[model samples]
Target: MHEKKYLILYSTQEGQTYKIAQYMAQELGESHCNLINLHEAHTVDFGLYHTLIIGASIRYGRFNKKLYRFIDRHLAQLNAADAYFYSVNLTARKEGKDTPEGSVYIQTFLKKSPWKPKKIGVFAGALLYPRYSWFDRMMIQLIMRMTKGETDTSKEVEYTNWEKVTQFTKSIEKSL
Candidate 1:
């Protein structure tokens, strides 16, 4: 079999998205993948990769601005490749289908961009209260209370389901 080329590109605020990208890349294997942070990736030659996975974390109900810009800059190349997008947010773990806000996020991006990824995954994000500032921590705590999510500020909390992430990655692999 010929070697496969995959690119896992991601942007992270507090590292959750980065971790997920790393996990996906590791599962995909070193030889087949090139995992890069959006900030570090200046010029991406999309033609060099057969598959591309882009991931970004949501903060205050919006995907990372840098990731969006990066995608916008390379929209044509992305659309030409086998591409997938994963949005990491706390709302994914909530007990409903895509919330109005989440739906808006996806729709807004789709409307603004030329690229329509082959697959879109929304994974639950983490609440790293310990890493937040006092004001942010309190605000997030209040948001958590309103959302009925964990509000514990004493420790870090991860809402990501690794098994689901694994399954999602495998699905991408199968598609490729």
Candidate 2:
């Protein structure tokens, strides 16, 4: 039997979303997967892949505009394939917010977008205060403070649960 082709696309600002995509790619075997950055991708031929996984980070309570545009442009192709979607956000670090139903961003995305994936994931992202610009750092710090999260600008914290990620990847593998 021929090897199944997988398309992994990611839209990341602080790179956490890309990190999750990389983990999935590695778990699925890099040779069988084509990982593309949505920000840099000009066009996508969804027909070339048997499965499509699109991951995007939530920035200031929204997904990247490019992700929406891409989905709008290729909604039919996505719906035809075994498509999966995952959202990365710090809010997911909180209890009861790590599922699609609990994640407001994911819910908003589903309601606002035309395409719905067969599987959905919600993962926690990192907070690198030192990596952000002054304005962003202050804004994120304020949000963190309100949420009772780590607000130290000098520290970088990663909140992703690798075991959950592995489980998600394994689910995809089983589907294939």
Candidate 3:
């Protein structure tokens, strides 16, 4: 039996989305999935893969512009494949905001995008205050505070649900 090839591509700001893509690729098996950073990929032949899992992190309430451009350019190829899209953001860490339908950023992106994937995921991102610049830290801190999230600038807090990620991957495997 031939296993379908899969691409796990990510556009990350603080590395959470990249880490999620890498972990999903590892769990799904290295032979079945190829993990790539969207920025460095430069060129991707969508026809090479049977399934596409695209992930992007939200920075200042917006996804990477390159992500939007890629989707626009390869919408047909991506739609032909069994495509999945996941959004990573601190906003998903809030109560009642964990699902794709519940996430403001995800809803906004999906409404604007022409490519609608087979499955959508919303993952809670991390708060790496130590890695942020002063301006970003302050901005993020204010946002978090408003959302009732962790506000401490000295500690890094991870809010991702790995079990949920594993389940999502298992579902993707089943799709093949």
Candidate 4:
């Protein structure tokens, strides 16, 4: 029997999504998983992997356009493989918004995309104030204020739930 090969692809703005992908790769064993940035990958042979996982972050209420393009180009391969998707967004920091049904971005992606993932996860993203430009910081602060989130831009805050992530990873392992 051949060892299962996994491909983990991510599209991130502030790198939280990629960080999550890296964590999953580490948990799944580096040798068994291949991590690729959707923006950087010029070509992807999706058929080479037994499982495919995509992690994408929302920026200004949208996933990257490249993500949709990749899905459109490889719709057949995605549907053929044991594929999963996870969306990362600041809105997920809220109590009820940390789920697939509660995540507007995930729901929108599922509705717009031709390929439906076999499983889905929703994770909260980080807020890195220092990494952002002055304009971005202000915009994010405003959004945070409106949502009753952490509005202090002096420090970086991570909202991801590692326990949930571990659970998601275990679920993936169990499915195989």
Candidate number of the best lDDT: 2
Residue-level lDDT tens digits of model 2 in 117-153: 9999899999999999999999999999999999999
C-alpha TM-score for every candidate? 0.91, 0.98, 0.95, 0.97
Tens-place lDDT digits, model 3, residues 1-176: 66779899999998999889988988888888898888777788887888899999999989989998888888788878889989899878776788888999988998989989899888898999999999999999999889788889998999998887888888888987
List per-prediction Cα lDDT, in the order shown: 0.84, 0.92, 0.88, 0.91
Candidate 4 Cα errors over 4 Å, as ranges: none
TM-score of 2: 0.98
lDDT (tens digit, per residue) of candidate 4 on 3-100: 88999999999999999999998889889999999898878887688899999999999999999999988888889889999999989988778898
Better of 2 and 3 by TM-score: 2
- Cα TM-score of candidate 4: 0.97
Best-performing candidate as measured by TM-score: 2
Range of the 10 consecutive residues with the lowest summed lDDT in candidate 1: 95-104
How does model 1 score by TM-score?
0.91
Q: How big is the positional error of residue 79 in model 1, measured in Å on the Cα after superposition?
A: 0.8
Q: Pull out the clashing pairs in model 1.
A: none
Off by over 4 Å in 1: 97-104
Candidate 2 Cα outliers beyond 4 Å, as residue runs: none
Q: Tens digits of per-residue lDDT for model 1 on 146-173? A: 9898888987889888888998899999
